[model samples]
Target chain A: MTDATGSEAGTAWRRIADELEAAIGRGDYQEGATLPSSLALAERYGVHRHTVRQAFRHLADRGLVTVSRGRGTQVTAPRFPYRIGRRVSMRTNFGAAGISVAGSMLGAEIVAGEAEACAALRLEEGAPLWQVEALSLAGGIPVSTGVHLLPVARFPEFDRVFVESGSSITAAFKACGIPDYVRLSTRLSARIASEREALLLKIEPGAAVMVSKAVDALPDLTPIHLIDGIFAGERMEMVVEPFGELPSPPAGESGA
Target chain B: MTDATGSEAGTAWRRIADELEAAIGRGDYQEGATLPSSLALAERYGVHRHTVRQAFRHLADRGLVTVSRGRGTQVTAPRFPYRIGRRVSMRTNFGAAGISVAGSMLGAEIVAGEAEACAALRLEEGAPLWQVEALSLAGGIPVSTGVHLLPVARFPEFDRVFVESGSSITAAFKACGIPDYVRLSTRLSARIASEREALLLKIEPGAAVMVSKAVDALPDLTPIHLIDGIFAGERMEMVVEPFGELPSPPAGESGA
Candidate 1:
């Protein structure tokens, strides 16, 4: 621990908390492991006990550790890892991780396509779309919500197929005679949840969420559908893997 | 607009805000376009002017639009799109978007490898590693901060080469005789920015930040380095593209 005497109390405490957080992340304190006593930490950092206590409070607030009356601060379990690859499927990903997964249809309807959906599906303006909203659960805990939009002309009665197949989009595609599809692209952003989303996900209104907008395509690069998903940030982490070669740059410069 | 008679004022306002935000995102209102008047929106939504005003306030607070005395409300410019792919060069990505990019070295040192770095680099315990901290700027504004860790033995003069090459990690790798590399995997999460990170990125403390942990490797699968980056959530969007075939699934039954 590096001590700078002139730093403010808040900065000092934050620095200490950051160090401890990094340590916990590095598995210095494994899952369910208790941290050292406040007095010991203070002595190690050459700070007052109260300062160490403040640091511990900060860590607890960040959901990194839990404190109880009888027990000391204990680290929380690691988050579940979800890999996004060429043939991505939420069911298969969580199943391989030893977590049972299920999907339930929240609602389904035919609606006017939004510009994003129209552009991604190459539909003209005013095209009707089959929109399906569903929630995915891992071990019975809601982890993500998805809104999928497909061209109604291409996949008529998609909602019926989706519901009849127990809310599996993959199965619904097969019902539409599509054997397989590939992920075309994914755009990621982060923001705080809205009031309605918070209620649905059972989290605070301003809690963090990871948002992804993705388009799936057929093997020949024809888009099939577009999906917008909001994932609970604390419950899942997204892993991205390379699935194709980088597009080569135009030739211009000579070899160095 | 869908209206529910018994909904709370907050819920109604949020609904209006959500609709307007979706419109803006879909380019119904292009960048720098002015939104409809509060009176017009109120009438369209069958709500009072004050309710529409509240919705506008919410949009402003979320950095989606700006309201002025004479000009009314105007949407802001879209964020820079950063595509994460097989090559995954920030310079190339920003250049294709016509944005001038620059990087500056914040700090560098040789430190004992942590678990993540050691595991990614396949290094033994207590191995020394070269760590570099940098800030990437797009159009003269800082957008991301990166902490890169590499094996010291592989690139002994990495720090000097990186600084001399105008803070280009790709150039430094080339200087070390590495002609090409590919991205192996990327993990993404979102959280509130810490005080130090907020200061560095010129954002408010506790604002949302997208964090990515990625490993780059040689063509034959030898890991090169690991990068942990924090991006200002509101300033940039990440685009993930597939670069290889997904791992084949085990033998299984056909369709249901």
Candidate 2:
């Protein structure tokens, strides 16, 4: 009965969501725990089951709940373990962990590199660069959106090459005649996601996101790419092993 | 005077802050850009200058503005660079940046090691651990709060040592016959601050926080301590170097 009309239904669901949120915030529900069924919640709130479903969807978008086919609705858990260290292959790592990931190109454009990008790519300030925006999803769930920068002088028309290669950065690099690359450095911070970012990631507005600025370098330490990644913080954890086994760098070498 | 009484003053300041927030979100203001003077904002809002100050204070607590001496109120920029690599000493790094930092003990208790802590410390499930909570401030601004866990068998009365040693972790380690330790691994995630954490960090209720779970090990890779650090996300950037020079582990040796 609460779903009298369009706007009325909207307001009713939001009210239910707010009450549920307050209950969750007060520890009335625990993480990895399931919520009552939609029919049960509808009866409790004296609303249509569709309205309860809408409320659940809103909470899921906020990263507070997970909706699965057989599992029903459960509190969100950090399920993805992202590895960050020397010699990390996202495809291999997440694949081994039974997570299927896919990348799609959002757009491509040539722009002047600013301070953060220029510093990461070891280019002069305001240098021309090819910027490509890509979104990656795991298990059909949007996980990260990355802004990739490549020096225009080094990789001309790289953006086209990226799209032609199905938005795979590695494929684009190989087409550019680079066999391999290594992550040189990364700087991470966290903040509330902007409106555009939330839309792209399918997360709620103002949701917390982990931002990483990373530089990829060639074998000789020549910087080739600068990547700014925005990760949905609720579903991922970045793992680092400081003493991981890796080859030693040559003595007295400075990265370009 | 619009600010007639206590609750009236509260409502007046919040209204101004909400309007300014909308302006900032629309990109009317830029990062690292100074806003108009308090007097100017007061004239625009038709409120007292004191009311404007309260609005600015509210925004600052939400990580939107910076009110520093002589600098007036500029947008907040990430100023603290936290270095994370093979060897990291918070005191040494922040001190090198000319920022004064102090650590204060919040509380200590004996608790059972949860899954995260047990795995980090390589302890049996449900093992006893000493959990010491401490807060660190940089230039009198709260930056991080850390929960440190140590084996109850090895670090008896370690909480007492921590308190007597001016809440210095290094001093406590030395007193417990640990000459040195190094971080072996770190796992990081980000989320909205809880009620208690927001109060301790002096941030808004739902502000983002970067959580780091780090394990410090002895020279032989025996896990010595587990630290869970909650960092105020707005003012910090965590820097990581993949190729930092460090000694390699001995052949075929596995961490404990």
Task: Give lDDT tens digits, candidate 2, residues B1-256.
Answer: 0112247776788788767766666567777789888999999988899999888876764456766557788787644878787666677668897988788888787766654456557678578988788898888888988788899889988878888877777778889998788777777878777666778889877788898877788878788787878889887888777786322223212111
Over B124-224, each residue of candidate 1 has an lDDT whose tens digit, in order, gives 75588887888988889889997888888998988888888788878889999998998877778776676667788897665667878888888776787
Best by TM-score: 1
TM-score of each model's B chain?
A: 0.73, 0.66
On the 0 to 100 scale, the lDDT of residue A159 in model 1 is 77
Scored by DockQ, the top model is: 1
Clash count, candidate 2: 0
Off by over 4 Å in 1: A1-40, A43-46, A49-76, A243-256, B1-76, B243-256
TM-score of each: 0.76, 0.70
lDDT of 2 by residue, A1-256 (tens): 0112347887899788767766666567777889899999999989999999888876764456766556788877644778788655556567887988788888776766754456556667689988778898888889999778899998987877877876777778889998788877777878877666789999877678998877788978778887878889887877787887323223212111
lDDT of 2: 0.75
DockQ for every model comes to: 0.25, 0.22
Cand 1, B chain, TM:
0.73
